[model samples]
Target: MADSFLRPAVSTMRSGIAGALIAVLALAAAPTIASAQTAAPATKPAAKPAPATKPAPAEPAKDAAAPEDPLPWIKICSKDADKKNVCLVAKELRSQEGQLVASVALRDIEGDSKKVLLIAVPPVVLIQPGMRVQIDKGKQLEAKYTICFPNACYAEMEIADQAIAEMKKGKALVVTSLNIQQKPMAFPFLLSTFKKAAEGEGIDPNAGQQNQEQLQQELQKRAEEAAKKLQGGDAAKPADAPATPAPAPAPAEAPKP
Candidate 1:
C-alpha cells in the first residue's frame, strides 16, 4: 500500500514540474516571437538640402583719365655737369613750327622743404590772367604771374602734398591763359613730367659752385676775345686805308713859299 501511495505522489510531482518548465519556456519565447512579428521602425533618410551658392562680385569702376597728347613730348631730368640732380623735370613745349612755346620746370631747392613749380608761357599771355591749371579736369588752380622775361612769362607756385598727389594720379593737366587778343588759349601738359618731378631725386650740393665757375670762365673767354679784337682793329685801322694823305704834305711845302 505504502509503495503505491509513494509512486502516485512521485507521478504528481513530475507532472507539476513539467507544467512549470513549459510556462517558463513560453515566457522566454514570447519576447522572441513579438520581436519577429514587428518589423524594425522604418527610419526615413533625411532629405539633403541644396548648397547655397554665392553671388558674383560686381565689377570695379574704371578710372576716368583723359587722352594723351599727340605731339612730341619729352621726360627729362636736369642735372649739373658733375651728374648731380639739379631739377626734377624740365618739360619744353614747341609749336608745330618747331619754336618753343612754353616750358615747365620743378625744382627742390636746398634748405627749403617746399617743392617749387615754375611754368613758362609765351609773352603773349596776359599777366593778370596768370595761369588756370586743371588736373584731369578736376580742380581749377590759379597761379599768379610772378615775373616776365623777354622770352616768356613765368608763373610760380609751391607744390604742396595735395597737389603732388593729384598730379601723380592725373593723366593730363590743362593750363589756360589769355592770349594777346585777350582770348583764352589752352595748353596740354603731360603728367609724365609731373611723375618724373615727383620722384624723390637727389639734389647736387656743388651745382652752385660749378655754375659760378663756368660763368666766370665764359666771361673771361669773352673778355679776352674782345680785347684781342680791339687790339687787332687798332692795328689794322691805319693800314686798311691810307691816312688822309698825311694832311697834304704839299701844304707844308707851300708854307715855305
Candidate 2:
C-alpha cells in the first residue's frame, strides 16, 4: 500500500513541472514576435499621373502669285567728269503728247555728305521768283534757279535729312513756280514709288545712254510735228497773198516839193 501512494505523488509533481516550463518559453517568444512586428517598414501610396496637353494649331498656307512690276522711278549711278562718283534718283513727268513736263531728281556726289534736290521745268518760268516745293500739304521749301538751257530751266537746293524723311512718308510732291505771266504753276510728282526707287540699284550706263537717246528722239519727233503743223497752217494761206505795202513813201514827194 505505501509503494502505490508514493508512486502516485511523484507522477503528479512531474506533470506540474513540465506544464510550468512550457508556459515560460511561450512568454519569452511573445516579446520577440512583438519587437519584430514593430521594426518592419510601412508601405507607401502610389503617385497620380499628370494631365494631357492639347496640340497647337497649324498656320494657313500662303497663296502663290506672279511678281508685280517694278516702280517707274529709277536710280542712276555714274562717274562725273571729275572722276568722282555720282548718283541720282530721278523721275520725269510727261504730258499726254509725250512732251516732258518736268523732272525731279535727288543728286548725290562722292565726298559730299549733303544731297541736292534738282528740279527741271520748261524754260517759260520766271527766274527771279524762284520755285517752291511742298510735300503732302507740308511746309513749303524754296529753291533758287541755278541755270537755264534752251529746253529746260534748273532749280536746286541743298536738301536736309528732315526733308528726305518727309518725302519718304509723303503721298505727293508738288513743285510750284511762277510762269512767264507771273502766275503760279504746280507740278505734282507721285511719291508712292519714291522710297523704293531711292533705295534700289541703278541701271547700266549703256541703258541710261539708250534712255537718253530715246528721249532725244521723242523730243525731236514732237518738234518736227509742231513745225509741220505751223508749216501746214502757213501753207493753207494763199501763196499769192499780197504783202501789206508800206504807206508808200507817202510824205517823200510832198517833202521834196
Candidate 3:
C-alpha cells in the first residue's frame, strides 16, 4: 500500500462534494423567485367597471302663423293739382294686372298734380303724384325721375324691355321707393314720359287710361250718390231722421257738508 495514492484520492473526493453543494443551493433559490413573480398578478385587484350612460329625451314641436294679405294695386283718380288741395286719399278699387283691393285714408294731398303715387302697405295702398319709383316686369323696367345739376330744366325717364321687365311687365311685384316731383310743371312732363314708355312696352294704353278714368268715374259717382243721399234725393232712410244724440257731460262732485 502506498501513501501517495491515498492523498490524491482524498483531494479528488473533496472537489466532488463542493460541486454538489452549489447545485443544491441553486435549485432552492430558483423556486423562491418563480413563486414571487406568479403571486404578484393575483394580488392585484380587477379594474373597476365603467359607468352606464342614458340617452336624452326628444324636444316638442313649435307653432307657426298663416300667410299675409297682399297690397292693393291702384292709381290716381283725379288729376286736379292746382288749388290748395289736389289729391283725395281713397281706398284702392283694383289692380291693373288683375284683382280687387282695399285701402285706408291717411291725409288729403295738397297742390295740383296729375299722377298720384300710391304706397302699398300690406292691405292698404295709397296713390300720390310727384312720386318717383322703380317698376320691373318679367323683363321690363321703367324709372321716371328728374335731374338738376346747375341749370337743367327738363326731366326724363326710361323704360327698357330686357333689363327690369320682371318688375314693370310682370303680373305682380313691390313698390320699393316713392318720390314726389314736388314741382307742379315737372309732374305733367314726368307723366307724359311715363305714358310714352308704357306704350312702347305694349301695355294697353287704353286699358291704363280706362282704369284711371273708371276709378275717377267711380269716385265721382260715389261722391254724387253720397251728395244726393245727403240732400234727400235717393235714400234708404227718411231725410228727416232724428239727429245723432250728444254725449252727456260729467257731473261735478258736491262739497262735503
lDDT of each: 0.53, 0.64, 0.29
TM-score of each: 0.46, 0.54, 0.22
Instruction: Candidate 2: give the clashing pairs.
Output: none
lDDT of 3 by residue, 1-257 (tens): 00010011211112232233233223212112222222233244459845545445534433232112122222222334453533222222222221222121112245322333223221111123222333322332233323222211112234233322333343222222222323221010011122223334222334444554565466556557767777875447766989899998889899999
lDDT of 2 by residue, 27-140 (tens): 212112222223345346458645536545544444333222122456778888999888888766543233345668888888999999988776668999899999878999
* Candidate 1 clashing pairs, residues 3+ apart or interchain: none
RMSD of each: 52.2, 53.3, 48.9
Which portions of model 3 show Cα errors greater than 4 Å? 1-132, 136-154, 168-215, 230-257
Q: What is candidate 2's CA lDDT for residue 205? A: 56
Error of 3 at 210 (Å): 9.0
Cα RMSD (Å) between model 1 and the true structure? 52.2
Q: Residue 16 error for model 1, in Å?
A: 99
Q: Which scores better on lDDT, 2 or 3?
A: 2
